[model samples]
Structure formats: C-alpha cells, structure tokens
Target chain A: MIELRDVHKAFGSNRVLRGVNLTIPGGTSMVIIGGSGTGKSVALKSILGLVKPDSGTILLDGEDVAKAERDAFLARFGMLFQGGALFDSLTVWQNVAFRLLRGSLKRPIEEARAIAVEKLRRVGLKPEVADLFPAELSGGMQKRVGLARAIAAEPEIIFFDEPTTGLDPIMAGVINELIREIVTEMGATAMTITHDMSSVRAIADHVAMLHDGVIQWTGPVADMDASGDPYLDQFIHGRAEGPIEAVR
Target chain B: MIALAPLAAVGRSTLAMLGTIGSVALYAAITLGHILRPPFYIREFFSALLTIGYFSLPVVGLTTLFTGGALALQIFSGGARFNAESVVPQIVAIGIVRELGPVLTGLMVAGRVSAAIAAEIATMKVTEQLDALVTLSTNPIKYLTVPRVLAATIALPFLAAVGDIIGIMGGYLVGVTRLDFNAAVYLRNTVDFLETADVVSGLVKAAVFGFIVALMGCYHGMNSGRGAQGVGRATTNAVVSSSILILASNYLLTELFF
Candidate 1:
C-alpha cells in the first residue's frame, strides 16, 4: 500500500500542492484525474520523491519512503512517464536492459540483451526491433518500449504518468489494456495519473479526482459516474460549463 | 529617470544571474557528494571517457593546432619592433596549455557533448525514459550523470595535453617553415621552457572544465521545463554555461597557479 499524508509543496509564491492526502491499497489500480495545472503531476512526483514535498510523509508498504535509503526505496517502484522517456543514444534493447546491465544487478551483456529482447517481445515487439534506437521507432512503439523498460525489473509498485496523453484513441486503448494486463498479472500496486476516461474505465479499480491540490472525490471506478462532486463531474465529462470554471 | 530605470534593470538582472550561479554551485556540490558515496556506475564512467575524451580528440587537436600557428605568427609580428621574435615558441606553448587548450576544448565539447547529453536526457525526462530507469531499480544519477561526469573529468586533461602538444608542434611547424626559426632550436626551447607545473595546471583545468560541462548538461536536462521549448532551452543553457564557466575558471586557475 502507498499512503501520502498532508503533502504540501510551493514554488516561490505559487502553492502547487496544498496539504493533499491519499492512500492506495496493494494489488489495486488507482487513477488520478484532474485538469491541466491542477497539481496531479506534482502530487505524483511528490510520491516518487522526484519533487520533495515541503512537509509531508509518503509511506510505501507502511514504511516512510521519503526517509528510506533513496536507491533501495526507488528499487521497489516502476514509473512510466507521460513522455515515454526513451534514451535516444541507446538502442531499444539497451534502454530496456539499462538497469539489468549495471551495478549490483550487472549481468553479462549477452544475457542482459537477451532479457531485453524477451521483454520487447512481451510488449508485442519483434526481436529484430531490439537493435534499433528509440528515434527509429514510432510513437506507439516508443511507448511500448517505455512500458517494457518499466516492467523489466518487475517492480512491486508501479506509477504511470499521463500514460495515454499523446497517443491516438486506438493506441491509447491498446496501452490501457497492456497496463491492465501487467498490473493484474504482476499483482503490483499501481497508481496512474490520466484524464482519459476510457483509460479509467479500462484500467482503474478506483478513481481519485485532484482539484485545488486535494482529492475532491474518491470511489470505485463504477461509482465515478455518480461521484456527485461538482468538480469531479465537471472534470470527468470535461464539460466546458460547470461549477468548476474552465479558467482559474 | 530613464537612466535610473536602466540601472535598476541591470541591478535586477545581476541579482538574478547571481542566484543562478549560486544554484549551480549548490547543484555541483550535491552531485560531487553523491559521486563520493556508494552505487558508483563504473560502466557509464568508461563509456563517458570514450565519448567525451576519445571521440573529442580530432576536433581539439585540430583547433589547437591552427590556433597555435596563428598565435606564433601574431606574436612574431608583434615582437619584430623589439627584435624579440625568439619569444614565439614559449608564448605559443604557454598560451596553448594555459588558455586555448582547455577553454577551446571545453567550448567545443560543450557545443557537441553538452547539447547532446542535455537533449538526450531532457527528451528522456519529457518522454519518460528517466522515470523508466527509476522504475527498473536504477538511480538515474548513477546511470546517467556518473558516467558523463567521470568521463569528462578523466578525458578532458588528456585532450588538453594532446592539444598542448599538437599546438606547440603547430607553432614549431609554422616557425620553422614560415618564420625562419631553426627547427632543432625551436624544439629545444619548447622542451626546456615547458615545466611540469605548467602542464599539470592545464590538465587540472581540463578536468575541472570537464566536470562543469557534464554537470551542467545533466542538471539542466533533469530540471528542464515542459515540451520542446524547455528541452531546447536546457540544451542551449548547458552549452553556454559550461563554456562560460570553463573560461572563467581557466582565468582563476591561471591566477592561482602563476
């Protein structure tokens, strides 16, 4: 389980996160939904320690991850960035196998490359494609490569940031299905941030709406349609006219 | 009032620039601290050496060679008034080792490597590659910054030394062929005048400059803003800041050593 307690963050005069708190039980998918600049990404970054919260505690499996030894704490989590963050200089296999081939996890180059190829194959990519660079792949393939790299280590916890942002609806659905498959298969605790309703329907066990730096609504995915909160209603439907104004 | 406004603007900009410099210094110290601790990435270090040092040789060698030749001609012509042409070889050697070798090599590498590292990492940050590394149980700093910084620091001095040698040779070639200096005497003068301290100082400068270049690239890329413009800005900043720091540090080191 992952728990965030009263997280606060500010940049100069701008308060991006204002004492936000939330929790996710293990072996479940929690999707955070929010509008642009609504602190969704900031909230996720805080959980991951990418952005240190001013005063808050993030607990993973009931232990304070923020206070834990960074590398060991980091070792348990996998994150799929919204941008697909592929290393352009390395080939697809090398990128996927990056961690496996270095430090205490070091494997022979051939063994690591083989595992990279297998992971690529798991994501519906051909063996031959592993030799190619990230730039050589299409957007969808890049995302798939990113996904493969994320799960390569089979992390206990997974975070997906705007997973379906730039893809076409068809590709988005495919990615959503793949994410669902991986979370279910691994039984990993998953937290995903996305405004894609279809993704919420496809992958989420529960949905949390972040607005004004706090979770405005939280419930099972089925209850999201009847969430009743004006902000949640306005955001889920992406309605132009609602209690939540289009502009701040 | 107009003059006052401009002065106020200048003062504000200066303060902002100072803030940036302070942050960079802080970032450098933190990275160095991490570097000293455990989880060092040795593979990345070797790879960086190959990329920053070995690959950069041709350009540094060529730039110093040409610059040395030109400096020799300029010094010889300037010295003609006092018939002090004998100073050409010594000046070329010192100038190449102290200034041109490190600064030009740093600038060139910054132009080539800094932008490349920043763009690659910023694109990763934007694209989710760095997050992927984190997920795979990898520290991005250990994986990314360690190798690049280690490579640049270790490789740069060798490049400077090579540049130093190549530059003096360039001056020697120019002196013997164009300036009518005897080849044997020019070689002897260069060897006799070049001290261990002079060479070591330049190498140390190269190492410092290398660290600056790689660190700037990683820092900007990791903290870069969103979208295309942010990555672009990071890349530009990395190159410009690295180059400027190299030149500025070169001056300070020179003063300290001399």
Candidate 2:
C-alpha cells in the first residue's frame, strides 16, 4: 500500500500540490484523474520520490519513502513515463534490460536479452524489434517498449503516467487493456494517472479525482458516477460550466 | 529611487552571476566526490575516451598544423626586420610548445566537444532520460558527467602533445618548402631551443582546460530550461563559458609557469 499525507509541492509562486492526501490499497489499480496541470503527475512523482514534497510524508508499505535506502526503495518500483522516455542512444532490448544490466539486479547479458525479448513479446512487440532504436519505432510501439522496460525487472510496484495520452483511440484501448491485464497478472500495486476517461474506466479498480491541488473525491470505480460531488460530476461528464471553473 | 534603478539592476546582475558561480562550484565538488566512490561505469568511460580523444584527432591536428605554418611565416618576417631571420625555428618551437599549441587545441575542443556534450545532455534532460536513469538505480553524474569529464581530462594532455608535434612539423614543412631554409638545420634549431618544461606546462594547461570544458558543459546541461530554446541556450553557454575560462586560465597558468 502507498499513502500520501498532506503533500504539498510548489515551484516558485505556483503551488502545484496543496495538502494532497490519498491512499492506495495493496494489490489494486488506483487511477488518478484530473485536467491538465492539476498536479496529477506531481502527486504520482511525490510517491515515487521523484518529486520531493514540502511538509508531507509519503509511505510505501508503511515505510516512510523519504527516509528509506534509496536504491533498495527504488528497486521495488517501475515507472512508464508520459513521453516513453526511452534512451535514444540504446537499442530497444538494451533499454528494456537496463535494470538487469546494472546495479544490484545485474544479470548475464544473454539471459537479460532473453528476458527482454520475452517481455517485449508480452507487450505485443516482435522479438525482431529488439535491435532497433526507439526513434525507429512508432509512438504506439515506443509506448509498448516503454511498458516492456517497466515490467522487465518485475518490480513490486508500477507507475503509469498518462499512459494513453497521445495514442489513437484503438491503440489507447489496446494499451489500456494490456496495462490492466499486466497489473492483474503481476499482482503488483499499480498507480496510474491519466485524464482519458476510457483509460480510467478500463484500468481503474479505484478512482481518485484530483482538482485544485487536492483530491476532490475518491472511491471505488463502481461508486464514481454516483459520488454526489459536483466537481466529480463536472469532471466525469466533461462539463465546462460548474462549481469548477474551466479557465484558470 | 527611479534614478538609482540602474545601480540596483547592476547589483542584481552581480548577485545572479555569483549565484551561478556558486552553483557550478558545488556541482563540481559533488562530481568529484562521486568520482572517488564505487560503481564506476567503465564502458561509458571508454566510449567517452573514444569520442573526446581519438575522434578529435583530425580537428586538433588540422588546427595546430595551420597555426604552426602561419606562425613560422609571421615570425620569419618579423625576424627579417631586425636582421635576425635565423630565429624563426627557435621562436616557432617555443611558441608552439609553450603556448599556441595547447591554447588553440583547447579552444577548438571547447567549441566542438563542449557544445556537443551540452546539447546531448540537455536533450536527455528534456526527454526525461536523466530521471529515467535515476529510476533505474543509476546516478546520472556517475554514468554521464564523470565519464566525460574524466576522459576529457585524461585525453587532452596527450592531444596537446600530439598537437605540439604536428604543429612543429607544420613549421618544419613551411620552413623547408616556403622559405629557403635547410630542413636539417631547421630541425636542429627547433630541437636545441625547445625545453621539456615548455611542453609539460602546455600539456598541464591542456588538462585543466579539458576539465573546465567538460564541467561547464555538464553544468549548463543539467540546469537547462525546457524545450528547444533551452537546449540551444545551454549549448551556446557551454561553448562560450568554456572558451572564456580556457583563455583566462591560460594567462594565469602562463604566469605560474614563467
């Protein structure tokens, strides 16, 4: 389980996250939904220790994340970035096997490559694509490659940041399905942040609505539509006029 | 208050400059600290050695060669004005070995390697590859900055030595062919006039210049703002800062050596 308590983060005058408090139970997919620039990414990054929060505590499995051994703490989590964030200098298999090739998770090159190929196949990419660079692949293929790399180490926790943001609807559905299936099969604690309604529906067991740098509403996906919160309704139905203003 | 606005602006600019200098110094200290620790990236080090040293051979060689030939001609003409044209080989040897060789090579490498390093690193930061490296349990300073800085620092002295030799050869070529000087005598004069300390000092300066070049590149790159404009600005800053530091340090090193 991951928990954030009164997390606040600001960049200069812009307070991106203001006293955000949320929790995700073990072995479940929790999707955070919000409009652009509403601190969804910041919240996820805070949990991962990528972004440090001011005057807040993030706990992973009841251990304070900021105080944990960095490598050991990070070794348990895998993340797929919003832009894929694949190393352009490396081939696809090298990117996937990056964790396996170095640090405490070191493995033999042949074994690592074999595992990378397997993960690629698991993510719907052909083994032949292993030698190709990220620039050679399509955006959807790159996303799949990113997914493959994320799960290569078989981490206990996984983060997906705007996983389906730039994909075509069909491809986005495919990725959404893959993520849902992978999270179930791995039984890993999954935390995803996306604004896509379909992705939220397909991948989320629990939904958290972040607005105004806080969680406006959070509950099981089944209870999301009838949560009786105007902000939640306005967000889910994509309404322009409501208690939540569309313009900044 | 309005009349004093210019003075306040100058004060702000000075403070900002000092802040940037402090940040860069702190960054260098951290990088040096990491260099003494474990988990060295040997593969990356060798890759940087190849990029910073071996591939830079042609450019360094060409620049020194042309500068050497030009220096010989100028020195010969200047000597003729005092009826001392025989001093060409001696002056050329000392000038190339003691100053021109390393300074020119350093400036050239600063323009080439520093800009390349800044642009590549800034692009990686923009793309979140640096963050990705962190997520993968790899330190970007160890994997990226240390290797490049170490390679440049170690490789540049050898490059300056090579540049010195090539530069002397250029003078020799010009001295024998363009001027009516005997080849054997020119070689002998150059050999007799050059001291080992002269060459060593230039090599030392090359090493320091190399450190400055890579450090500036990594610093600007890591602190780059977002987007294409940011990367471009970082590249320009890296080259400009490295060049200025190289020239400034050259004067100080010359004072220490002489």
Candidate 3:
C-alpha cells in the first residue's frame, strides 16, 4: 500500500501542492485527473521522489520513501515519463533493457535482449523495431516503447505520466486499453496522472480529481460521475464555467 | 537617486556568480568521487576518448601550425630592427612549447568538445532523458560527465605534445622557405634552445585546461533551463566560460612555469 499524509510542495512562491492526503491500496490502479497547472504531475512526482514534498510523509509498503535507499527503492518501481523520455542515442531494445544491463539487475547481454524483445512484443511493437532509435519512431510508437521499458523490469509499482497525451483518439483508446490490461495482468500498484476522460474511463479503478493543489475529490471511478463537488463536476464534464474558475 | 537599486542589482549578481561557482565546485567534487567507484562503463570512456582526443587532433594541429608560422614571421620582422633575426628559431620554439600550443589547443577543444557536451546533455535534459536515466538507477554524473573528464584529462597532454611538434615544424617551414635562414641552422637552434621543462609545462597546462573544458561543459549542461533557448544559452555559456577559464588559467600556468 502507498499512503501520502498532508503532502505540501511549493516551487518558489507558487505552491503546487497543499496538504494532499491520499491512499492507494496494493494491487489496484489509481489515476489522478486535473486541469493544466493543477499539479497532478507534481503529485505523481512527489510519490516517486522526483519532486520532494515541502512537508509530508510518503509511505510505500509502510516504509517512508524519502528514507529508503535510492537504487534499492527505485528498483521496485517503474515510471513512464510524460514525453516517453526515451534515450535518443540508444536503440529501442537498449532503452527497454537499460535496467537489466546495469547495476544490481545485471544480466547477460543475450538474456537482457530477449527480455526486451518480449516486453516490446507485449507493448505491440515488432521485433524489427528493437534496433531503431527512439527518434525514428512515431510519438505513439515512442509511448509504446516507453511502456515496454516501464514493464521490462516487472517492477512491483508503476507510474505513468500523461500516457495518452499527443495521440489521436483511436491511438489514445488503444494505449488506454493496453495500460489497463498490463496493469491488471501484472497485479501491480499503478498510479497514472492524466486529464483524458477517455483514458480515465478505460484505465482507472479509482479516480482522484485535483484542484487548487489539493485532492478535491477521490473515490471509485463509478462515483466520479455522481460526485456532488462542483470542482469535480466541472472537471469531469470539461465545463469552462464552474466553481473552479476557468481563468485562474 | 537610484543608488539602492544599483547596489541591490550588484549584490544579486554577485550572489548569482557565487552560487554558480559553489555548485560547480560541489559537482566537481562529486564527479571526482565517482572516478574509482564500481559499475565502470569502459565503452563510454573509450568513446569519450575518441570524441575529446582523437577527433580534436586536426583542429589543434592546424591552429597551432598557423599561429606558430605567424609568430615566426612576427618575431623575425621585429628582430630585423636590431639585426637579431637569428632569434626566429629559438623564439618560435619557446613561444610554441611554453604557451601558444597549449593555449590554442585548449581554446579549440573548448569550442569543439565543450559546446558539443553542453548541447548534447542539455538536449537530453530538454527531452527528459536525464530523468529516465535516474529511473534506470544510473547517475547522470557517472554515466555522462566522468568519462569525458577522464578522457580529456588523459588525452590532452598527448595532444599538446603533438601540437608542440607540429607548431615547431610550422616555424621551421617558415624559417627555411619564407625567410633566408639556413635550414640546418634553424633546426639546430630550435632543437637546442627548447628545455625539457618548457614542453612538459605546456603539456601539464593542457591537462588542466582539458579538465576545465569538460567540467564547465557538464556543469552548464546539467543546469540548463527549459527549451531550445535554454540549450542554446548553455552551449554558448559552456564555450565562453571554458575559453575564458583556459585563457585565465594559461596565464597563471605560464607565470608558475616561468
């Protein structure tokens, strides 16, 4: 289980997170949705320790994330960054197998390559694409490769940041379905940050809406539609007019 | 009337400069600390050597050659006033070995290697590749900066030695062809006048300059701001700062050697 208690983070004077309290049980998916600049990404990053919280305790499996040994802690978690963040200099397979080829997870070259190829297959990428660099691939293909990389290590916890951004509706739907299938099949604790309503419907088991740097409402994906909170309703229906000021 | 504003601006600028220096210094210490650590990537080190040293040879050689030839001509012309034109070969040798070769090579590498390193790393940051590396449990400093620093430090002395030889040859060519000096006499004077210390000191300066070049490049690249504008500024800053540091350090190195 993962738990965040009164998490507060500020970048200079712009407070991005304010006393964010949340919990995600093991073996489930939790997707955080919010408008631009609402700090959805910051909340995810705070959990991953990419962005340090100004004041809070992030507990992963009952141990504080900040106090954990870095490599050892990171080894159990996988992350797909917003841009895919694929290494341009490395080929697709090399990027996928990066974790296995170095540090404590070191494996033989052929074995690591085989695992990378398998993960690529899992993400719907052809074996031929393995040797091609990230720059040569389309944005959607890059995202698939990033997904392949994220699951390559079979990490216990996985985080996806804006996974469905910059793709067509059809492609976005496909990615959303893939994320749901993989997260479910792996039985991993998944935390995804996205504002794509389609993505939320397709992938989220539990949903949380963030507004004004706080969790405005969090409940089962089914309850999201009937939530009485005006902020949550405005975000859910994509309305420009609501209690959450559109201009701000 | 606005004395306070100017004073505050000066204070802020000074603080910013100090912050930069402190960060660079701390980063340098961390990079050095990683030098002997395990999980060493030999491939990266070899590739860095090729990029920082082997690829840099032609530019270093050509720059020193032209400068040496020009220096010979200038020294010969200046010596003509005192009927001391025989000093061409000796002065050329000292000028190349003691200062010009290392300084020129340092500036050229700063332009080539430093800018490339900064731009590449900054682009990596812009694209979020550095963040990915962190997820993969790889320290960017170890994977990126250390290899280049090691390669440049090891490669530069050899480059300086090669540059010094080429520079002397350039002067030799100028003395024999352009001026009416005896070829054997010019060669003999250049060979005899140059001390072992002169050549060694230049090579030492080259190593230090090489370290500075790679260090500044990695520093600016790691701290670059967002977007193309940010990467461009980092690249420009890397080259400018590395060049200035090279020139400044060259003077200090020369003063010590002399």
Top-DockQ candidate index: 2
Q: Please state what fraction of the native interface contacts candidate 3 reproduces.
A: 0.81
lDDT-best of 1 and 3 = 3
- Cα lDDT for residue A165, model 3? 92
DockQ of each: 0.56, 0.82, 0.81
Residue A168, model 1: lDDT of 97
Q: Residue by residue across A129-191, what tens digits does model 3's lDDT show?
A: 999999999999999999999999999999999998999999898899999999999999999
Q: Kindly provide the TM-score of model 3 when superposed on the true structure, using C-alpha atoms.
A: 0.98
Writing each residue's lDDT as its tens digit, candidate 2 over A215-243 gives 99999999998999999899999999998
Model 1 lDDT tens row, A1-248: 98989989998888988888898999999999888888998998888777889998888888998778876777777778787877777899988887787755678999999998988988889999999998899889988988888887778888888889889999999999999999999999999998889999999999998888788889899998887888888888889999887888
- How big is the positional error of residue B62 in model 2, measured in Å on the Cα after superposition? 1.2
After the best TM-score superposition of candidate 1, give how far the Cα of residue B251 lies from its true spot, in angstroms: 3.1
Q: Where does candidate 1 stray beyond 4 Å?
A: A103-111, B1-11
Considering the two chains of model 2, state its CAPRI-style docking category: high
What is the DockQ score of candidate 2, to 2 decimals? Answer: 0.82
Whole-model Cα lDDT of every candidate shown, in order: 0.86, 0.93, 0.92
* TM-scores of the models, in the order given: 0.89, 0.98, 0.98
- Pick by TM-score: 1 or 3, better one: 3
